[model samples]
Target: MCPLFSPPLFMQRYQFVVDFVQAHGSKKVLDLGCAECSLLKQLQYHGKGVELLVGVDKDSSSMKTRMHSFAPLSSDYLQPREGPLEIELYQGNVTQPDPITRGFDLITCIELIEHMQLEDVERFSEVLFGFMAPSAVIVSTPNADYNPLLPGLVGFRHPDHKFEWSRQEFQLWAVRLSELFGYSVSITGVGALDDAHTDVGFCSQIAVFNRKPSQNDPTNQHRSRGEPTVYRLLYSVAYPSLSDNNVLQRMLVNEVLSQAEQVKAAWLSGEWAAKMAGAREPYRQGGDICVSLLDVWACPQVKHLCGTLRRFTEALVGERRVPLTPDRQAVIVPTEEEDEEELDEEEEDEEEMAAVEARCTTTTTSVATEDWEEEITHSAVGELTACHVLAHD
Candidate 1:
């Protein structure tokens, strides 16, 4: 028997929700019936502008076991969150009214309503649309219309599912609830079949409900009514971010210095190669090369620079060790060995002066001085190791 879908039905469902949340720029989001917290994990990484995320489920043990997955990783510290993010998981019944979950920008109930009893489904509708009324809501359930296509499949998709609704049945229920609660509803689906089986609709049906304002609605009274907390907090995490001034500066300085060193090392290698080939020095100064800002950004090691390009460039320039041209497009990198070379040249000049003062210099002084300068040049070039150039046009 073949698997139901190529990319898998669960992944498609999560992608659909992620796209919607990101496009809408929803700040506060709640996921109802968030089993194993799979959807929550995806949103934390992919959902833009989502500051607060909450998950509600009845399974406490599973949530606790999976909580460790949300911890900060090494990459997370390297590239901290753009803004503050908090994720909280609660163990509670969806049918019950909770004041804490009110005024959310978005709420998702993926494949959840089908598992509750018929009575509980009604209670959940009232709780979600009336008391916990959010700006928008998303619900998904198994499509009974597509069941016949599955080989040897009988009844609902899962044993826990109380009822699987056909396309017409799900639409009718959604439309009725929307009218009663002062909301607009739209129906869509995921996990589609081939053109031949298009009439059967999708394996999973989705309904998106958006609340509408009313002059005098009974549900409006529940807005101010404070209800006691019923859901037990299972797990909570406040993500680390670069919002801290100290953290931002510290990380920025480290990366700038690291890139500067790499650029300087590359400059030294090229100068040494040119010298060995009997060509004039490739670099203008003592192994110092000029690199464009674009060249610095192109390096794979600098790809993790956390903030905007302009902001990061400003921080890079502020490092003091990295000196940029007046145009700010390129930086002049001086080789580490250049300082030693300058000291050597000064010492040589001082010795030559001392010999002349002694009046013991012969007619061969000019040739001998030339030979000594060549020896010093060779010593500096031989010490350099080969490195790849980070500079580009």
Candidate 2:
């Protein structure tokens, strides 16, 4: 368990979203489904340059509890009588047009989309992209393919979650939404990886979308309809920024070191060696073991360790004189004595399998080869530990 100032995997995701939001220099921020206003509270503690923070949720009772708790706190930045926090609480459904005014710089909906029915996601997107028209939007949800990584986990992560999407599924949806909304998207993950299933890695995934400036221009087709008065403001208060502690910084260092150790252990255990031997059948049948292993190794969190493991695997394969089929040219050709019909059938099957494998290989290799600074900077670490927050503010 992580300390109050250092959140675990699930909470860490909120930090990532907040970091992205802060990096964009957003002032007016709105969080959809802001249950307990926990995310807003976190921002108050760690965030910089945020001027206005608005939180909306369907549960009015939770909003009341959060508002009441923060109302009494006083500081140089926040006065109890004057209410200096610049925070607003609203009870409203996120599926509809946001009740707040237009031109919000950043909007976030974390772990909320999966609760909606599959068919309703489109409408939710329309409201978010078309009606809200924020400069940036950050969304996150559970990664279904990653469920196997969780110990004793069964079914969805939450009972209310309508569906958990696989990486491909989430990517497809993000791509479609980006096209429809004129936004560019980047996908990343949050969570620890188990050795048993490192391919999919993270338990949760996030998609950050930056709406094109041109799309917000007057001539654009999808213009915001201004603000609507749909939500009742529960209260407004001032929340002071909390001082930072070295605890979070230390915890992140420990986490990175722990992950590096895990990668080393996996490699030293001869797991990759065994996987390399298994590659023979797959490679001959037009599949790629390297590509599959690369998916697990490409994560930024363990890139250095992964590099060592990758080199070790390649070295081991070389020493064993193992053949690696990189493409069709490397595949063994059928002999002239072989039956024509049987050869034709085999070729057809191999071609189809090769096509699919080629796509996977291309993507995995690109991620593996992308240039990233070997040294981790403070900003980078801050991004990595985005969920860490003070217990109170």
Candidate 3:
């Protein structure tokens, strides 16, 4: 079997993994539940300046790998990374509230929730919010509906995973948590799943979350009203640079996506929908995770492997940040020849029209603020209205 099937020391919800590194400026990422610290290593280049990759896990043996055991929760550099990284490995349960978690722009939790009891997740998410800045987290888990037992391919199954949730079940929790905590949630996929058949332990999401909202939001009345299929794809495809200018790029990308059918009906063909449909809409669970395919595709490396699909992902990312003009139209070219033609077309169009494209931040970005309002008005509003009466459990 190819090594690609080999899971990381810890399961990584890939979509979130990218966004967290990209959004948090890559400098101060807290890799909670990090297994081998390999994932943290992958993120090393993305860090901008004060970049620090902190990997936390309870396994003492993980300490031996290429990282330093995080110094006990202290302001000083806990195990500094051997390279430019300031990676820290700590013997602690990220699920529990710790002062060390704060100041981070992004957080990652991939397939770790299944190992914890439901009651533990309830408290864990609570603690999770405490450690993060108001924006940006990426998480993923199995879609229970597909597996009925656990999502994702089998064989990695562990006795510890408590109750694997269906896509719906996970989202129920995610939506509630977003409402309660004031974060925006989006989702992506770690690996593709079979919709016609079922696979046990099949991965469901590459969920992303941002505690703080982008200043330029995407919530026009029309934003959330679309057929969610394309939007989920759009979100992932444009994520890496979308946070530029504080997700001004992300919002603009969604804005274009909102009107993509106008660009061409073929882009929205039934075959396309069938291939890209989500097991769940906005697939974020407990409302704290967000998704972006650009985040998925923007490996700063993986683009080569995904090939033409990579270009589709890149074009999607560019469309969001590049401002449209009264005269300019986004050309769709599904072929290599068309791509060359489009570049030629862009130059001709560039001189003819005024570029009103949005200004994006250079730092890694969280989700847009409009999604914040959507979470509030749609799901969060009702959930927030619920009185915080203590649960009997």
Report how far residue 131 has shifted in candidate 1, in Å. 1.8
Better of 1 and 2 by TM-score: 1
How far is 103's C-alpha from truth in model 3 (Å)? 0.6
lDDT of 1 at 219: 36
Using lDDT, give the best candidate's number: 1
Candidate 2's error at 304, in angstroms?
Answer: 46
Model 2 gets an lDDT of 0.57
Order candidates by lDDT, high to low.
1, 2, 3
Q: Could you give candidate 2's per-residue lDDT for residues 33-149 as a string of tens digits?
A: 887788887776566677677888877877766665544232432211112236777777777774363568788887788888997898888888877878888888878887664
Q: How many steric overlaps does candidate 1 have? A: 0
- TM-score of model 3 (CA atoms): 0.44
Checking candidate 1 for backbone clashes, the offending pairs are none
lDDT of 3: 0.43
Per-residue lDDT over 1-393 for candidate 3, one digit per residue giving the tens place of the 0 to 100 score: 112222421233443465556554544566666666555655654344434555666554554444432221221112212233334445566666554555565676755777687888888888776434434666666565543332233532344557767666777787777777767776555433345443433445445666645463322112122222211110111112222332333333434333332222433342222113331111222322222343333332224323454454445544533433222323221322335665776576444322211111111110001101111111434322112111100
Steric clashes per prediction: 0, 6, 49
Give TM per candidate.
0.65, 0.55, 0.44
TM-score, predicted candidate 1 vs. hidden true structure: 0.65
